[model samples]
Target: MRLSELSVGDHGVISDITGLPPEQRKRLVALGLLPNTPVQLIRRAPLGDPIQIRLRGGDLAIQKRIANCVEVCLK
Candidate 1:
């Protein structure tokens, strides 16, 4: 499933990131959104455009479009 589809409090390991521009992909990786990393959906904006997530000991808010490119395997 895509990260964007995860429900709040869901936990998963990142499987892949695809369908994104190279720069965006690298930025996400730099922010610790890498394959095999554990992540949880923390919350979402009122309109759901930006979603908050917990990963690598920190929380990040990313656009739904970017989250849609991130694949995850639920734990």
Candidate 2:
């Protein structure tokens, strides 16, 4: 499933990141979102513009449109 489809408190391992340019992929990796990393869904913005995820000892918020491109497997 895509990262955007995960619910609050859910945890998953990233399987792939597609449809993004190299720079974008590198940015995500720098944020500790590399493939195979486990992440947790924390919450979503009230307006749903972005979703908060817990990773790498911190929380990071990502736009839903971008989240949709990240495929993950439940952990």
Q: What's the lDDT for residue 58 in model 2? A: 97
After superposition, which runs of candidate 1 have C-alpha atoms over 4 Å from their true positions?
A: none
TM-score against native, each model: 0.98, 0.94
TM-score of candidate 2 versus the correct structure, residues matched by position: 0.94
lDDT of 1 by residue, 1-75 (tens): 999999999999999999999999999999999999999999999999899999989999999999999999999
Write down the worst ten-residue block by lDDT for model 2.
28-37
Q: What is the C-alpha lDDT of each candidate?
A: 0.97, 0.93
Among all candidates shown, the one with the greatest TM-score: 1
Error of 1 at 71 (Å): 0.1
Model 2 lDDT per residue over 1-75, tens place: 999999999999999999999999899988888888999999999998699999878999999999999999999
